[model samples]
Target: MASVYKSLSKTNGSKEDGPANGVKKNKQRVLILSSRGITYRHRHLLNDLASLLPHGRKDAKLDTKSKLYQLNELAELYNCNNVFFFEARKGKDLYLWMSKAPNGPTVKMHMQNLHTMEELHFTGNCLKGSRPILSFDSKFDTEPHLRVLKELFLHIFGVPKGARKSKPFVDHVMGFTLADGKIWIRNYQINETEASKVTSADVEEGLKKKEKRDKTGGGKETEISLVEIGPRFVLTPIVIQEGSFGGPIIYENKEFVSPNQVRSEIRLKKAGRYNARAEQGIERLAKKGELGLRTSGGRAPKKDELDTAELFA
Candidate 1:
């Protein structure tokens, strides 16, 4: 009888406030960090994103870039399920990495045209750490890789319910749109205002509802509008790895060109122009020597009809 009571008590204690069949709740904590060489803009963007994520843990600059799998251990240390990493290269290019820590399917993207919230000067604002509605373009559902990207964005950007630092209100929206093989990100504030509309039919009603409202003054209808709140950036997917920052690449963007190559091509073109000008000058000098128009080996100057000596004579 005592054993039965103990068993019942044990079962009662094991019961949790979650769904049945062993499904877990959507609880996610993210580790946000960047490599050491990031510039001011990259740091600001990181801060902006960190501020928006109440459940994210921001750490100091990572010291190494080669052993990125160290991020998994760091995430495990912080009890974070997701990792958001900013990798800076050549002190100018910024790459973003998103991964499910201690697992597979990591995404590496080249970030471009990033603007911090302070730089944008948008009038729209929301309560910090407030939950945001994620609005995705229809294109995300069209392809397999896009679907994977959408899942990553949802995991990293979506604030779960009852986040420790999150506000109770949902006051903003995060928009992700895919166009021209890149993802564009935008944030907007949700503005609610009392919707006041008086039509001819309402006037014909003899102001009955207005008189009722004058007596009561209770109900008000609001219209919801979206105003731009920014920290806008674009991401071009470069590759998807099979592990956390490691493993074989599952997807690669063949069309994506490196910034180094682009810069080198521009430099080569300029050098080609300079080389052509130098060759033209050399050709002109050769032609002058062939025509005996140029003095050689310190030879005496040739006397011409237009020479100063001849003119003075």
Candidate 2:
């Protein structure tokens, strides 16, 4: 596979002065592992993932004994920063461990489908490509799993459960459902169905339901009224790059406001009262000529009269 890429890169079509495959060599190195010893399916997944992140070098293929010390050694050997591990379980369930080398957080996940890959559509396009891939199996792609999958995807991609893109960067979603329990994700495109398709009566019915929800704060409050979000199709999962999930900062906030900067209403009211009383006290003193060095016109004297500079000296 490396030879193929090297050969293709060799045809410079022009200079061919430097290493043609240098670009590929610079990609991040990774090792794929699986517990219960790697099976055929694990290799398939590793190959597909390597192809997806073509820039990355596959330092080593699936590992049978995915112990912690071995993983540390592999990372050191290849200077790899990321490693993906899969643990096969009873039926078709799988536990996924994404180990970030040199002390980064390992994202752990459990997935459902494993046996259904052949029947499922595996695409040439990577998950991060603009047009994401999404396909659902009509059989196991039903209730509970489907419902749970929806919730899981929403949380992972930083998308609102109400189906809104909280941040513009995560606009695209790649997702699909499988019979055995595996999920492939892709971005979502808005449907071309026109708003004119909805009749005036439908709008009226929607408004009534919304009004009821507003008054009661029931689940129906979330019932389909606004159509900007709540896409009818499946959503995709977010892509992990550089062993880092670089999506928008949570709550659209990179850092929190300092405690001193947060001025509550109570504090503001107290401050206003203190300022007002101070001003009133000065006014009272000035009226009775008690405030030091007042002008004849009853205005406070200028700083020149106080000789603050001389006092400091």
Candidate 3:
């Protein structure tokens, strides 16, 4: 009888028909890992990114590269809906993969110009796990593939509200700029200071006065400025897969050239230079041989018909 009453209450709810609370929950968790053979710089970049994401789960390095489908199972194990993966080649080239776990549409990008926060030594700093405001270039909205990439970046980097371990406040901004067929990433701390200052020298004094006012107990807040806190890098998108790690390709960058191809072209140019020099040397030797200028190997000069030796003979 109790079960029947509960069923009726659930089925015949005319007073309020929607969700118990008319609020949508934005819940997201990410699994972050890298393939083996990544250099220390790549590892440090991964660490810096993981530190920034409160909802991310960092795991051991994946052992296989060819079978990326294994990541789906790993994400499910960790209750993660997104995966951020790093794949390294030749211990130097780093490629990043961002995907929605257990589904389609994955992005693969080649990473370049990486610089870690430790190396950059920027004065800007923010609280660990603090949420960041994402800023994207206007061009991201203009194209279809760029829009897809923008969405992926939003899901992986944007900290969801009420996420576990996330700070309640936002203190940094992550800027994504599109230029030269690549995505440039930068992080900046939101530095709040008094807005009345007019010059660089006055700015420090103004901040000091503001601090004193606060200590004495009350002052109005001022405007904020950006100070770079960097783990800077660029990514050139190579392809977008329709599935998490498998499936048909939805988009491919025709302008993007692989690092291997670039290196091979350089090698060919060098080889061509050497071959040209070798051919020049052979031609020079043959010319010397025809003139009988070579001491060791050359055709003797042909005797003229009117030469003194021929007439005397």
Candidate 4:
């Protein structure tokens, strides 16, 4: 007799859908690093990149907006084995990728350097085994860089002199296949996840709730009535993660009661920046401490007192 399970659909999860059968799934971890600012163009590029990979492959696009350290974190998060750097802008923007894992590769792209020859030489030493792809836009001539690049590629790929002439020197700025047949292209646009927005109705409802509380003279009302107000700005030192990008911290007067509170507020912002400056040697000086905080302290140190040498050192 025929088995009753023979006609079952794969959707119900059966042995036929299992990997034990001849079926195999392709899993790829891809990281896209782009220097272009996020724009509508990115949407198009993202779609194209999605098409290049096999189905079921995981992909992450790290744009210029992302923190420098986040790139490394993402590499670890996705177990990325290959990285694609998309240089979409002009001028030299230094790109460096350092892998903590011994097995991973390091890739660097130095665009439009005044010292092209020297830069290429230095890059050759830094990125010995890894593939380094240099891109030049229409404004810049690739001829000079190409000359050095050709020699580098020849040394690495071991191309015969005659065969090198026939091979296309530079791939199209938009897209091209690597020596290994891996497809790579510089696409300006790609899809990005957007933050959700609250509607006007939501704001109206919240205002109505506040009106009700005002009428009820809610004992719980903690609102402060200010007679005088002035423009105020808060400066908070932020720590930037090694592989992540860092930016300014702007807060309205309503946000903090004191400078000390800024640290706690920042913790709420992103756990990564919490206690950043303190770890780097910045200490908050209270008024009393500022007067005679140190053994030799007299008055608060001037702005120059903050030594940034440690950062560069």
Candidate 5:
């Protein structure tokens, strides 16, 4: 097993480098994890990893765009047995990969969301079998998040479930950025008694107080952050071009496709051509790149799916 290193290329390109043999000291295998549909975010992680690697180190870099066959080939080419897996989402796919790669070095890269360190620790413990390590960078306040995260780590790794006793195995390396742009790394240990005080009750009471203030007209609604609104998911526009009928469509599966489809059932009415036009309009508004068509029983449409008389009216 060799040490994994970041991809370094000034042109910002992805290409395999080094010899074809199965033994090399300068080459290491790494996996970049991210939301399946979002390649741009994956690129950001690549760039960040490149920047973090020690300068002037002779190392091989493999991006996720590289096919699995290619990665295996590179592994064999470099005699590489070690793997580094990076996680950027809360999704379960990363855990699946980690479970499959039990013999490799797995690292989880996390974004600083609102819950911050607490979420990170939860994820780390949930994927404890992965032997996970974490890296986070965000504009959010770190002190509170760090404290919460540290407590979670202690709770998961040191304190046994349903027990009042704490273990001494908790240790961590923390890095913080200062107001002057300097970064500092510090060693720390967790104090369980203090950490346990930060429970769900404390958070619920705080929220209750906020609600009471809002009801009494003590605070403005606009002050609340949009993150408190609801659930969030990434939406990507898919474009499909064919002849002169190029248009956009929404891809619900997050898989990329080409050319949009106009539902034939909607196109069957006496005035149903307008349905295609309306779909085109929606595609334009949504900036969709790919379209999906729903058909029934290998037939275009039946009387139930569309009403011819109503369409004409």
Candidate 6:
């Protein structure tokens, strides 16, 4: 009937190469913009990312590495709703994420700055939300650079100084470090602490260790217990449907080399250079007749027959 044909046409138009469930099957599309570190390993990583999400696909032809301004334009052109931007600069790494959905904008960003292992102790511990605290091991009571890094972190986390008294300010702890000429970023969760009464032998020993005399001239001592809380994780660079933080990497250090890939480029280049030297060596040896042993080691002895007289005797 005419009605059946109309129904079939509509279904076919909305059909996707997926399951035949009752829901509409439009493929999930994501756009990745990167160039500096693109390699076979990265491609495999991107493919892995796509596989994590159900029905996700990556458009390999369209690349938007340095072209951030045209994000929206190319996204619409390619009909991709999710996009990720990655970059590296001077041992620092940056990441940015944006969505081209109809409702509203979704953006997330992460950065890793360079730092020495000894300089990580200054941040101390986290005292807020159910996230862990990520602190450096170095004490920077006088280090000016540490101060600057702390200030930069204020843009992404922490509540205003004035409003903290009214509403408790507690959130995740974000930090960075520089290693292998690249900056690495990490996120942590700081959880609340609940006080508990302790009376164990170990607790008593700890109490003795932390005993403090009263300043009031009273012959009394006080002991305090400390509890360490917080869980930490290294945030990888691969773009995901949604990560711990909802931001993308818009900026990164230049000297940064992403993970899961080897630094064999230099070796490959050196191999090319050595190729010419090898050819030159071959020519030199040929001229000297070293490799041309057939000519120098004496024309390989003429094809003389065996002593037939000796064999007959």
| Top-TM-score candidate index | 3
1-313: candidate 1 lDDT, tens digit per residue: 9999999987876684443537777889999999999999999999999999999999999999999999999999999999999999999999999999988689999999999999998777899999999999999999888999999999899999889999999999999999999999999887664556543333434435456346544457554556677899999999999898899999999879988999999999999999999999998887777667786832345679998889999
lDDT, candidate 3, residue 196? 55
| Top lDDT prediction, candidate number | 3
Better of 1 and 4 by lDDT: 1
Question: Per-residue lDDT of 139-196 in model 4, one digit per residue for the tens?
Answer: 2223432233232222222322222122323211221223211112221111111123
> lDDT by residue for model 3 over 1-313, one digit each (tens)?
9999988887878336446546755678999999999999999999999999999999999999999999999999999999999999999999999999999589999999999999998777899999899999999999998999999999899999778999998899999999999999999888765755444533444545555445535356665566678899999999999999999999999999999999999999999999999999999999999998887787987888999999999
User: Candidate 6 — worst ten consecutive residues by lDDT sum?
Assistant: 225-234
Arrange candidates by TM-score, descending.
3, 1, 2, 6, 4, 5
The worst-scoring run of ten residues by lDDT in candidate 3 lies at 196-205
* Whole-model lDDT per candidate: 0.88, 0.43, 0.90, 0.33, 0.29, 0.40
Q: How do all models score by TM-score?
A: 0.80, 0.33, 0.85, 0.23, 0.23, 0.31
- Of candidate 2, the 10-residue stretch with the lowest lDDT total is 226-235
Q: lDDT tens digits, residues 1-313, model 2? A: 9988887777653236345544532223455556664566655765554433323345543445434446656766766666566656542445565555655344444442343234344221122312222334454336543444443333223322222112223223344544223354432332221322544433535645456346545442322222121112211221222223222222121232322344466699889999999999978877766444555546564467459796786
lDDT of 5 by residue, 133-237 (tens): 222334223654333333322222222321212222332322332222222222222112222234343353465445533544533322221112111111121
Candidate 6: which stretches are off by over 4 Å?
1-152, 158-171, 177-182, 192-264, 267-292, 296-313
The Cα error of candidate 4 at residue 88, in Å, is: 5.0
The residue ranges of model 1 lying beyond 4 angstroms of the native Cα positions read 1-17, 20-22, 197-221, 288-313
Could you tell which candidate, 2 or 5, scores higher by lDDT? 2
What value of lDDT does candidate 3 attain over all alpha carbons? Answer: 0.90
Against the true structure, candidate 1 reaches a TM-score of 0.80
